[model samples]
Target: MDGKKQNKKGTGVKVALIAIFMIICLGVGFIGGSLYPLFQTSIFTKDSLITDQLLSKANVISQYIKSFYLEDIDQEEIESYTYRGMVAGLGDPYSAYYTKDEYEKMMESLEGSYCGIGVLCQKDEETGDVIVLNPFKKGSAYEAGIRAGDRITKIEGESVKDQDLNSIVAQIKGEEGTKVTLTVYQQSTEKEKEFIVERRETENETVTYELLSDKIGYIQVSEFDEVTANQFEEAVNELEEQGMEGLIIDLRNNGGGVVTTAQKMLDRLLPKCLLAYTEDKNGTREEYWAEDDEKFTKPLVLLVNGQSASASELFSGAVRDYEIGTIVGTTTFGKGIVQSIYPLKDGSALKLTVAKYYTPNGVCIHGKGIEPDVEVELPKAFRNSLDVPKEKDTQLQKGIEILKEKMQK
Candidate 1:
């Protein structure tokens, strides 16, 4: 009987242990179910889940293309188009994705030095023809008898009508000592001409200065590049040496360039003041300032028009804010956003509109251009010409007039 009682006690102990195990497992299950939603809502997990979905979709599309595409695929071209599309989807005109070759060319352009038959050209708005603005004096194109106002119609016998400017430029640029054949329609001669020009490394001159009548200095800034700051300073110093009592800065048709170069140029002109500032998406602010070491104290006038944009607008806005100069001409192009180029490991780059820049007075001029103190319009007849004579340039004459008045004060 005692042995039977001990067996029942052992059975009871076994039953209690089994119950405890069941309860522990039930508690764990309840806790895990409760925390699952929290895990799904976590920042890290949320991003990962989205990324996984995107990858899955991309993989499916890629597999379909590989399986059923009719033509032989150029994988590299497809990859480049994919990246280009991704950036284009952002709907920002200033943002772009550059392939390896494109990125290299872009950097070369910003450096203001490149191996090419040096000629600056722009597509005529009304005629849709690429017109040569200026052929660098010592460059291959100039030596080959290319002149301003000539329309480029063919590159290497390929018709370039309606082609993109950058595409045409890329075709023109090549390895040093290479040759490029161009067919141009000369407007002055009213005849078509062809020439074969050799490419060479050329430095672009962005700043040009002259001492105008009445000791008024004239500086035309076409665009700001890496070499612009030093060139601008040299221009100013030379004009000052010539006893320049007043100045007129012509920024008409200037489409802008490197922002830091603009800031550097401003530093040479302004005394210890805030030049400009930018705020990124994260609300991070960066400020540019001009030190008090040097300042231009002469009577000043800045000329702008619809084409003066980006860094040019920044320079104009700062001068206006400081009351250092009188702005003459129509409103500016008003590109107040800033782009940051992020280089990838694969030699590609992404230029994104990362920030909105403001003037020293906290004015955001992105869509709304800066209005001039004295607005004057260029005559319709002189609009298309690359070199508008000072007498015919009503806007420039107004700037000169304003500077003279300021100097008389």
Candidate 2:
């Protein structure tokens, strides 16, 4: 009888606890329902000056312009200008606000293909000079002899001085087979040259592979994109089937595209270890690690240059820190910050820098680039000269020698 009483007491306690939990939940629900409308109004309150002063001012200005302007106003144009102006105020070269059309093109570019001459150009912030980063293989820009390190002087007879990269790109891109003449300062010849490149729908393939001497595989990664990691995997598999003894990854003039894509490629090549990490403004950190699994264990060499940035630095920096491969060529571009795309409802978007990346060893290459294990510089004479023989590329030769030595070891 005492045991039955104790069991009944325990059951009563559990029942009371459950009842209390249910009451608390109902109270929370009641409170939430009561405050829901207030919360909504607080966020969108027009009279809340402390919370929405800037937006209110903007609305006022827009209304005034619409009411008293001399001519009709395009609301879309005003909105675009406002968004662009706000992004420009950030003073960040990497951050940009894209209109719907521009955002579409940007998306296409990130997908490893676009309808253009297929040349990646970067503007020097200090010098205001536009330089070609890379000319896609078999694209019109490549066929027209445009190459990396070439300065774009004019597009369609208009001077490119003080023109931003987007404007220059817009002028160069058009319908397929439409010719766009460009004046460029050729880095190889140190002379001005003109080329009438026909604009076409070019697919910018990020990965290309070829066989090197002694069954060595040479893979060039032009940029990191959504499709790049898969392409790299296929290339590696094919090279392995071809009896490749070593591998050389050329990242010359490769301005980085996507961070996750680079991380995926690193996961394929690196051993089980910390590949990379990132830190936000709030001091929160996120790390990327690899498991001891199917990683490419062959002798490897990576080629980088001053143009290799962001994701390129992530790959090369981790490779050096982990001692996974021999990094050859000059220092990388040293862009450690990561950007995120926030797409607006109107098909527009904003690309903003949100966090900074670090290598596995906790080294940040923001302003200072990653130093290579073997430093090699390509001669300026062979920079933009597509016809230059492989023997003349000293950097490539150094990479090849390093890989061969590693293979022997």
Candidate 3:
């Protein structure tokens, strides 16, 4: 009789707990129902609603992939692809999502240094061939007999035909002291050979300057990297020390890089004035300026071509607007927009088109390139040549001629 009484007590406690749980759940439901209208009206905006739908669709697709996919799935790769796709959906060609490795490589390029064989290359658009533009004299590639104008046909015994240029270059670059083999086709000799090159830390020479005839300084800028401004200033100062009376800045085939580097270079050349300005989607204007501490008051000539874009155009546009230099060669490549890299906590990055930049005179060159004061086309014979003779470079000749005329004044 005592045992039966204890069992009844235990059953009463269990029933009490169940009743309390149900009451709490009912209270929660009542509170949630009361707040539903508030949430619908304030929290769930149109954009958030659309985002919810997108997330729901993504979840459905992910579940199907997980449940019925034929092969093993890489969750990390899927997440990366999702991030890339999100950025690519914006439909802007200049914007992109970069993985950790890609972001690191990009930073290295912008910093103007890397561990590689030290050969600059470009992809031929028409032929889909990777051609060596320059092999640094002290680099391993140059030491191994690689020369400019040679076509890179294969990397590490794999054919690079129609391969992405970045991938090919990545294959060529490896850990320091590692060996990379390259098969090069020399068009001049009509010969093909394999080169065993060892990778090492190499610095990019973005600015090359020399004193030309009649005390005129000639500086060729390949790209505006982080170290470019300092190099350019040093070059200009050295040229001035050598009695440089006029200057010619060659921006031919120079695809732009860091925008601030161009601004810094302009700061050294221009006086106190508004350099350029950018306007974002909200019409918020940000301006760049050049102080009057230093200026190049001598005759200046800027040579630009169809491939001169972005920061190159910025420099050219500023020079033209200020009336400090005469712009020669063809019109610029017309990229007036600016891209800002947003770094994430995961070591990845997103480059987005942030704003449209304009010259000091408020001229936007997007889709409408900066016209040269004197337009000169490259001769057909020199167009295909990697190294055109100085006398045969019609556009450069025109620039020199204009600088001489200005100097005489």
TM per prediction = 0.76, 0.69, 0.74
Pairs clashing in candidate 1? none
Task: State each model's CA lDDT, in order.
Answer: 0.69, 0.67, 0.69
Error in Å for residue 167 of model 1:
7.2
**Per-residue alpha-carbon lDDT of model 3 for 90-148, expressed as tens digits?**
97655667788876654443232235787656555445556675677778888898886
Model 2 TM-score is 0.69
Q: Give the winner by lDDT: 2 or 3.
A: 3
Each prediction's total of clashing residue pairs, residues at least 3 apart in sequence or on different chains, is: 0, 0, 0
The best candidate by TM-score is: 1
Per-model C-alpha RMSD: 23.3, 17.9, 21.1
**Which lDDT tens digits does candidate 2 get at residues 113-229?**
224677766565545556775677768888889786787788778887754454455566555656778899887799999998886765657798998879899999877755679
TM-score, candidate 3, is 0.74
- Please list the residue runs of candidate 1 whose C-alpha ends up more than 4 Å from where it truly belongs after superposition: 1-70, 104-114, 121-132, 145-172, 181-195
Arrange candidates by TM-score, highest first: which order?
1, 3, 2
Which whole-number lDDT from 0 to 100 does residue 91 have in model 3? 73
In terms of lDDT, the poorest run of 10 residues in model 1 is 16-25
